[model samples]
Structures are given as C-alpha cells and as structure tokens.
Target: MSKISTDPTRRALNGPTMGTRWTALFHVDPAIDTDPVRAALQAAVDEVDAQMSTWKPDSDLMRLNAAPVGVWQTVPMPLLEVLVLGRDIGLASGGAFDMELGDAVAAWGFGSDTADPVQIRAAMGRHRNTAALEIDVAGARVRKTADVALDLNGIAKGYGVDRLADTLVALDLPAGLVGIDGEMRAMGLRPDAAPWSVAVEAPDPARRSPHSVLALHNAAVATSGDYRHWIDVQGCRLSHTMDPARRAPLVAPPASVTVIARTCAEADAWATALMVLGAEAGATLARQIGLDALFLLRDPTMGFRSKAVGRLFCDQCPEAAAQHAQ
Candidate 1:
C-alpha cells in the first residue's frame, strides 16, 4: 500500500540506538497517540542491532561468527537477508566491499579493541581467505568456509533505515521520510505534493555544507566517506573503511561516495564499495550495475570534485550542482 497522506498534521518520532538514532517523519491524524507507534519503530531497529551488531558479543551475528567452520548456523530472516545481500555486493565488487572483516576492523581499533599488529597480521593471512562467506537464504542459515571474521557494520545502518521505512509503511504512515544516520528513505510527497528535499552533505569534514539537495520520493540514499571517521596511524590519518586487500584502513580513501537505490541496504553497500574502488573504477561499476551514484573525489590540485551517474539526483537543486561544477 502506498502511504499517501490523507491529513495535514505532521508528526516526527525518534529514539537513540546504534550510537546514533532512528527517526520517522510522517503525516498523522490529530488524535493518533503515536507512542505505541514510536515504540514499534524503536523495536524494529533494536531487533536489527540484536541480530547483526558486531559490537555486541551476544548478537546473533557474533554467535554465528564464533561457531565452528562448516557448521550451519540458523539466523533470523533479517540477518539472512543482510548476509545474502552483503555476499552478492562483495562478489559484484570483486571483494572490495567485504563483510567479513571483523578481526581487521577490531585490530585497526575501529571496533572496541585497541590496534594489535599480531591480530592484523593474522587477519591478513595470504592464500587463507581472500574472501570466504556462504549463506543459505532458503534455510535462513549460514556457514563459513574459512577462519575469517564477519562484520556487517558497513551495511547494518542502512538496513536499519530500511527497517524503519518498513515499519512506517506497515503502520500505514501517510507520506513521510525515515532515516538512520545518513541513510534515508523518502516514502511519498508532502501535503502539497512537493517531494521531500534531502541534502547531500559536502565531503569536507572540517567544514560541513550541502553539496546538493535531492527531491527524493520512495527511494533511499546512502553515503560512504573517509572524512568523518578516521584515526591517526604514526602521523598518517586512516579512515575506518577497511580495504580487504591491504588488510588496513584505506590509505587515501575517496572523500565520499553517495548512492541512491530502491533500498537503503543497497545504497549503503554500494557507497562503501565505490569508496573502496575510488572514482574511476567505482564509476564504471556503478554504470555497469545501472545504479544512481555520485562519487566525490579529492584531488591534490583541485580539491573536491564529484561525478554523478545513472538516474537523476540533482533535479531539485540545479544551483548546488552548478556550484559543484565550478
């Protein structure tokens, strides 16, 4: 059912989780209490975190990761969906966007643990696992062929956003936008039928500004960037984004990669993949996959430059696009 608005009053519900927050903006009847609805939305994302979080030791994903190799582990449907999607995207990106990098991420201090060279070396063992992950979607089960670790941190937030959208839609929210972190999904037009305006943040972490504003409707957008999250390694700054081949944070990761997809999960995964692939190769992959993406590149001579491909992204803000062009 399309959630078209029947009333004009707008209501927003939000709560904190995943070190961030999940929010829903929608049209509601004046009498609707929205307390129950808010709780349901929070529960939705909480379930996702319980099923997929790498930070939580008791999470379903951690349990599965701790299980013996080749042993089939039953998991929730949402987890199964994420594993399958992550596997597909990893394969499509030629292992550029690996989901099984828990040890490396932890070793690099991106996770809770401090950086350890031994763990990093062990995690980056050659001829052992370039990538080894398997899933049985039909059975809602998973089995690893190698000793590598699993982490869905890259895509879980976007999946959380999708879950928020699903909850609002299930609750019959009449036309609104939902988001978790930077991943966002717009459900429908406003009361005036004007599309919801979503700003694409400029990739500069030092100075935040809008690169462009998108008129989003029933679509999701996600960005992966190197600017915001980083750590200094011996005077060299490294992003939280891990490169599987290097077994370390991207040395000079792209400034940002934004993707608009039918679902937030895809957008999240692809944005990360593109950031790993850089501007040129990422643009090629985005084109081949027929996805709408914008790659923000950092040039030593030119500063920040961006390229957009597949589907219209800046149809709402020509002025911002023009400014970016210059």
Candidate 2:
C-alpha cells in the first residue's frame, strides 16, 4: 500500500469474462454516469470474447478457423491487430509462441471439451516461418498458407485487460488501473497521484503469494506460469500452455514468465511465447525485441531463482528482484 490512497467515493467494479473476472479501480465524480461506464466495460470484454474465444463455436476466431484455406477472410479490427501481433511474435520467437495451436489447444482439453486422445496424437508443431500467415492489415483480412488453426488463447486475456483499460480511458478516467485475472494494465497515476501497485504472483502452485510488487504507470503486464491451469496426466502435472512439438504441456518449463509492454495483449502473448522459448532462448529474444521480462526458474540446488532481463524489470524492480534473489 502507498502512503496515499484513492478517493473515498472511488467505485470498484468486477464481473466475469473469459472464465475469469475483470476489475477496475477508479475514482468517478458526481457528474459521471457509472451505469453506462459499467456497461461499456462489460461490453468491451464481451466483444473480445465473442471474437476470439475458442470455447465459443460461433466466435469470430472459430469462424475464421472454419474458413477454407487460402481464402482472405475479413476480420474485425481488434482480431486483426491481435492476429498480426501474434504472428509477428511467433516469427520472432521462431514458433516458440506459435499462434496456430488451436488444434493442439482443443486436443489438450483446454478448449470447450475434455482432451481427446485421438486429436492429441494428431497434434503436430508448425514449421516456423513468417511467410506462412498472410495478413492484409489495411484491408483487415487474413489468409493461411498452411493448414494451421489460429488460437488466441495465449493473448486474448491480456487483450481483455487492455480493453478494460481502454474503456476506462474512454470514460475519461485516463489514470485508472485495471486487472483481468492476473493480467494488468495501469493507465496512469491513481487519483491521489500515486502509481498503482501490482503484485507479481509466486510460482508456487500450492500457495497464492506475491513474489514481488510492481509500481506501474502507463504500462501493462501479463504472467504465464506452469503453476495454474494445469491437469495431471498419468502421474505428472501439465500446464495448459502446451508444447506444440510433443502435443503436451511444456516439458520442464520455467516456473513462470512475466512480460511488460505498452499493451496487455503484447504482454500476454510475449509471456506465453517466452515461456515456450524457455529461459535462455526467451531471455535472448526479449532482449532482442526490446521487451521487459522477468523469468522465474527453479535452481537445481538453490531452489527458486529469478532472472530478469528487460528495461522495465531492471529499472523499476531492481531492489525487489535483488531481495527476491537473496
């Protein structure tokens, strides 16, 4: 907690979306219409779910998935943006964060149904290449050169966070802070002119604890970890973030990966992508792409250790990271 807190009349709102809840911490004046604000916030995220959710059979993403190969299907602007960014990161990460994992995701039981052994057996990794997905940004259209199903599971929640932030901004509360599940975006300072404090969740599956706290201003963060959203297969635990090559949860994955960027969607996708890249390769790619990332890994003998490589983590959380390392 900061020395200063937001206003006494500051309203808090939250509701369900994408199997998780969205939150807003904002201060509104008597002149503001809160009912409309709430509706808008809810609508923004619902629109995203309608467009991107793999669970929804009629979602815009599923429709695109059902489209014939090589056809340039028209997509909404938001979906277009996420698809473009997903592919860009996919290419940059060498398919480590591949967006074309819809089949694999559904096969792993992360989608609308239980895992199918048959689909799991058929799931295969994509050949990394930027040329595989063709996007007409100006026209808001997309085409796939290969038979890859587009899945935005890695990035949609973060985009939802960004949407919440966007709704707040639209209501003229440019300084409000928002969280969707654990993904967060700080629009600006609080009403008291204090930076919003966000907690970085510990990688321990058995406990809900803050590994560290972040002072966020005009930034967004998303964390992808093996701790949550996992299922036990045979005897071992597996994260929902599957490995394309093996058609299973990422093998020997990092405990967690946190990424900060200007947009929550970018943070979301990059976090998943970097997790897939593992600590070494992911860190290198983050540095190359000028992204801020903190990687938490288990040291064989030393236990939990964090390796942070990015301008944001290095600058804002230097002291916190140091204390955690100790």
Candidate 3:
C-alpha cells in the first residue's frame, strides 16, 4: 500500500482600491469557492478608501477637516486608529512624518485639485503644529484645538493592505501575501514552506526595476522615494513628499528609503519619516529604534549607493558596495 500527497491550488485575486489595485495570493484547497473570498477582500479595501481618501470630497477625513475647530467629530473606528498611529509617529519622528500637511499636498498639485499659487502661498506661510490635534480613542472621535488639515496619504494604502490581511484571517485562510500598490504584507510561509519574495524598487524615473530582493515571512515592507510622483517648478523637479518646516517638497532628499516592520502601515509611515530625515540622520535614528531600513543615495561619480541599517538590510549592502567600487 502507498500514500499520496496533494498540493493545494494557488489563487491570485485582485481589485481596484485607493486609485490602485489590491492583490492577494495564497494556496487553498482545490474544491473551495473563491468568489466569497474575493468579495470580502474588496469590501475591506473599499471601506479604507471611503474613510481616509483625501481625493474624495465627502470622505470621513474630509468631513473632519470641515468640522469647526474645538468641536469633536465622530469618525469611523478604522480612521481613528490610523489618526492615533500617525500622531504617535509624528511625535516620535519630531515632525518629520506630519499628518497635518493636507493643504501643502493640495497646494503642490499632489491632491485631487490642480496647484494654485494663492493656496501655495497660504500653505507655505501658515504655521502648524501636530500637537493641536486630539484623539478620543474610546469614543472614536477627533478634534482640532487649532486649525489643522489631516492627510493620510503616507499611510492609507498600507492600512488598506492590512485590512486585506485581516479579511483573509477572518475568512479562515491560513497563509497569504497581500499588497496595495508597492506596499506588501506576508502572513505565513508559501505552499513550498518558503518566505514570500518582494522587490525593493530602484529609484529611477525612466524605468521600473528592482534594486534588491527581500524574503518576507510574517512581516511587511514599504518604500518612499523621489522618482515616482513629482511636480516641476521653475525648472526644478520636486517630489510629492512635503517638508513640515518648509511646507513644500524637500529641496534635496535621498533617492529612496525602504523600511521593514511588523505591519505594512508602520513600514509605510517610517519610510516617509526616514526620507525626510535624510541619509545620515535617518540611519542613526533607524539604528537607535532598532528598525531595519535601507537608504539609496545618489552619487555624482557613481550612479547610486546604499546605507543599510539594522540586521535585515546589512546582507544586501555588500552587493550595492561592490557595484560602487567597480
């Protein structure tokens, strides 16, 4: 007598959310119907977009923005959670990861509307503070002590990925890899009992390619870079990331910064924070906090170089160094 072993079927599901697509890959029994799973995943990301989108005029976040200062506005639980996390990271990063930069984002044409000079001047001249915002977690409400416009562009898509992961767990799926845009999270090992492979994109506006590869198991990764979205002003190309101090795009920043953390949301926000902090200061903070990050620097002589922090990225440093040495 002999025993037989069968491998589960591989399933890849995707749908649109947050101006991009959300993808989920997993292996499941061949007999299982995936329609319900697809529906659940779509619903999860749709809810996130409904609550946090800056482009949506009537989104929950926009409603909060319209509310009078010093008055509490009730928001959805998920939005509240994200606001709290954003505030915490804002304080930790010393305003490098600001959540109150909606005006600047809109002024610079990164939001739903086109850039306006009047609005740009207003955003640049106005003084703002992250401490002005208040969150009542128990009641799921938030308010502004002064005037502040909150934007979750740096974190929303990652949270959308997290919601997809949660939906899979609720659906009783054992293992999966989920992503929205470039942000990704891996729940468990693959059918072959190996970690998921994700690419760290090179900072090149001309083309899309990987700078390095990472093996992710029960973790998440995110990248913030200057090459993707930008605006041209007076012959200068500026990235979408805003400096809280200048209330404008960063003058000079690293080509890209990648971070790996326990959750996709954390990785996304931290990547932005580190990008604003620049390479030297960012690397120091990344090490102090025990975060795994890789900074891709632009070189006048060489094309690009890397400064890696924490244990996870150290192995990849050698290849980058070797290229520069050549």
- Which of the numbered candidates is closest to the native, going by highest TM-score? 3
* Tens-digit lDDT string for candidate 1 (1-326): 33444455788889987888888888777668899899999999999999988889999989988999988899999999998899889899998889878888998888878888888787777443754767777887888888767889889999999999888888888478889887898887787877787788888878889887877877888999998888887898899998888778887777888888889999999899998988788888888888778877787887877777775634233333421110
Candidate 1 has an lDDT of: 0.83
Best by lDDT: 3
TM-score of each: 0.92, 0.91, 0.95
Query: Cα RMSD to native, each candidate?
Result: 4.2, 4.1, 3.6
**Candidate 3 — what's its lDDT?**
0.89
lDDT of 2 by residue, 32-108 (tens): 66888889999999999999998899999999889888989999999998988888877777777777777888888
Clashes of each: 0, 0, 0
Candidate 2 Cα deviation (angstroms), residue 42: 0.2
Query: Positional deviation of 302 in candidate 1, in angstroms?
Result: 4.0
Name the TM-score of candidate 2: 0.91
lDDT of each: 0.83, 0.83, 0.89
How accurate locally is residue 290 in candidate 2, as Cα lDDT from 0 to 100?
Answer: 86
What tens-digit string does per-residue lDDT give for candidate 3 at 1-326? 22222458899999999888999999987779999999999999989999999989899999999899999999999999899989999888988999999999999899988999999999999987758888999988989998888899999988899999999989998689999989999888898888888888889999999887888888888999999999999999999999999999998899999888988999999999999999999998998899888899899898998889877877356433211100
Can you tell me which runs of candidate 2 are displaced by over 4 Å?
A: 1-8, 125-131, 300-302, 315-326
